[model samples]
Target chain A: MPIRRLLVANRGEIAVRVLRAARELGIQTVAVHSDADRESLAVKMADMVMPIGPPQAAKSYLNVDALMKAALDSGADAVHPGYGFLSENATFAEKVESAGLIFVGPTPEAIRIMGNKSLARETASKAGVPCVPGSDGVVDSVEQAVESATRIGWPIMIKASAGGGGRGIRVAHDADELRSQMTTAQAEAQAAFGDKSVYLERFIRRARHVEVQVLGDGKNAVHCFERECSLQRRRQKILEEAPSPALSADTRSRLCESAVQLARSVGYRGAGTLEYLYDDVSREFFFIEMNTRIQVEHPITEMITGIDLVREMIRIAGGEPLRFKQSDIVMRGAAIECRINAEDPDRNFMPSPGKVHEVILPGGPGVRVDSMLYPGYTVPPWYDSLLAKLVVHAEDRPTAIARMRRALRELHIEGVKTTRGLHLTLMDDPRFQAAEFDTNALEGWLAARAPAASPTTTTSP
Target chain B: MAHHEVLSPLPGTFYRRPSPDAEVFAKEGAIVKVGDVIGLVEVMKQFSEVQADAAGKIVRFLVENEDAVEPGQPLATIETA
Candidate 1:
């Protein structure tokens, strides 16, 4: 089926993003919402609206039964799980497919194989993709972790086997530190992901967080180059840009090809991103894991490659083959995306959720504001803090930076604190301009700027 | 006895316990002091301790566990000496 009707099983800006793509494709859109999102922009723009459940995500968005019922009730032939919630969940994908509705992403097997960190590493290695040297599988005990740490060398990272997005990670430089942190890491992992199993990997110092965007049609896969997402806070990417400044032309080609090889090995379908750790010192990259859905930073890639990734993913889900060859998809101008979050950057990046009294989005050529914000819209605290993404493209990185600075200045969302100031400061940062930072750079920069303070009060801004 | 109502300082989801497996921070009829954590308000994934502003015995919690809350909303009532 060509997806005559689509159900968006998510909220926030991504929901609006999907609605726009569906509208352009002439697909009837159905927006599913919790009680808190009844008056959301997505609901207003959707052709039909369905209330799933209460405000909590568990009773609503994450509830597979509720989502499926909504899909069927709204007459949607396809369901778009827009990043997070159930987007990468293999069971959810299986359920959607078994229910005779199209899931706008990869096959369930691919999601299952790549969702686990240890298993994904094994699969990558089997595909001849370079991966970080680590333990063969999940470390059983603290003694076993210490044993593996010695072989993997000191400064190993204890990562949750079933975790992603930097959750349940602990780094130890020596045996004593490893022994002490091992149980804590396991407990944290179990608490966060419902899995206590963890794996050890050699922690790469001064490594840039690079990921290649790949699209597949179950048989053929092509890379859309790479994105430099090194500027992150606590493992969360705050800013991202396509065509990494760290990679040379030769290295970039090899890195992108390895990502495609890994995707092909898994028989991936739709759009996905292969995350890698790029060591600037050795000029080598290692595949860490693969996100089997449209990433939040997909827009920057779209800007540079002229490929609407969300649209392409939906088309692929609708049984369409790859539209362009590797050579046809060319990276043109440099593009950068600044994540405009509802956070107080100066006050330790505390979450700032409130009603928006005013909204001033930037315009003109090369500037795009992808957001769900509107005047009188109250940002509920039940979801992620991301309010908008200010994306800008230019001829080169420097010009892109300048354009981003201009756009950031023009963006003014009143009533709630945002990361606008932080991004503006980054635009002027020499190290950021020179692209001389890694995954840990943003945290260090933030800590230096404002020393540790007491825990944030529950006072709303 | 004087009665005092503890209001939620911020809006979000309110949880009586620190973690899912943990017990409630302060049960009803439990004696609480000023600045004692009675619950937690999670706003956009960041948790902030909901502290009682006055020393008293908690009469009852107005909302159930994991209920949505708003700023200045009464969460619990305390019977003070």
Candidate 2:
């Protein structure tokens, strides 16, 4: 059955993205918001506005009962958990379906199977997807972790089984450090993920972060190719581009095929991403984890493939088979996405949440801004610092970079600090231009550049 | 007595009461023992109790109930013994 009305179970840019897609598909859209987000762009864009609760996400976005109640009261037949929040939450997915509402993502089983890091690695191993050598299962004790580290070789990653978005992890390079870091890692995991159980994985030094986008209808799935997300800080991606800068054609094919294999093995539905850490030295890629929701870097894939992933997820939720098969999907052009966060980059990326007194968005062909910024809008202090995503596409990588530089220069937000200046600096850097940087590139660049940069906040004119 | 500040360890909404139906954990000028839970900071839906690290009397909260707080933001002042 097709969805009559859809409720976007999220806020910010992604919610606006879903509402736009829903409009294009002629579906009525409902926006759920916290009190702080009542004046947000998503609320203004939505066909119907529903208050989930108070300013805190716990009382609002993360409140499953309130969300379901809002969905029911809004007459929405389907709910789209637009990445993060409850997107990969298995119980929330189950609750959505159990309440007779269509959940516009993977099934609860896929989420449950992939949301758990240890279980996900096992599933990938069984599906013939290569994974980082690690403990076979959850490491029970310090002795078990030490044993696994010795066997898997030193420089191991102690990760929380339920960790995602680059939290609940610590890297250890020696036995003594391993023992010391293990306790801290477990405590951090317990505090962050509500799970103290962790597993160990061989840490790759200076690895490139690559991920493949895939769509499924539970029975069949296809890959939309890969994205290179190597320029990250603290394991959180800052910039991403489609058709990995480092992978050869053969390597790309293998990586994408492996992601599709994992998705198919899990009988996945809707849009999901399989993340991998690619060792540029050996040309070997190991499956890291599967993100069972639309990724933040999805626009780059959409720009290159000319596919609307959010729309596809909605269609798949409506019982529609994928319109295009593996053969029909063609990747063209190169797209680059820069995450503009509301942070003072010169101030060690401290959160700079404030009212957006003014906003100037860039335009022109091949440039898109997925954002919810408007004048008088307050970038709430209660949530993630992401202010907007600026994406640019062109015939090739250099052109894409050039376009991104121009687009970034034209974009501006007043009354708050943003990451735009850092992105502009990256665009002009030789290493970034040569695409020779890895996940540690940003941290290194910032360290070297921090001393020379003045304390004054630099805003784009 | 020196005034000691109690700062939030993370960013979130600060709560004066434990819950809606519960009483406020502490009141201004109330004597507090070391390591006593005085309030809570709710971030990402997780409640972390704001404990008084020093024995003191409450000197009023810097933020209102349900107000958003940030890491290192002063929650309250304590008149340390």
TM-score of each: 0.94, 0.87
First chain TM-score, candidate 1: 0.96
lDDT for predicted candidate 1 compared with the true structure = 0.92
For candidate 1, lDDT tens digit of each residue in B1-81?
999999988888999998898889999999999989999989888888888899999999999998888889999999999
Deviation (Å) of A331 in candidate 1: 1.0
Worst 10 residues of 1 chain B by lDDT: B43-52
DockQ of each: 0.55, 0.14
Model 1 DockQ reads 0.55
CAPRI quality band, candidate 1? medium
> Which runs in model 1 stand beyond 4 Å of their true positions?
A452-461, B1-4, B29-35, B55-59, B77-81
| Candidate 1 chain A lowest-lDDT run of ten | A452-461
lDDT of 2 by residue, A1-461 (tens): 99989999999999999999999999999999999898889899889999999887878999999999999999999999998788888999999999999999998998888888999999999999999999998987898889889999988888899787667778998999999988888887777677898999998888888999999999999999999999887667899999898999999999999999999998889999998999999999999999999989999999999999999999999999988899989999899999999877776666677779999999998999999899889887778888899999999999999999999989989988999998999899999999898888777888788876533322111
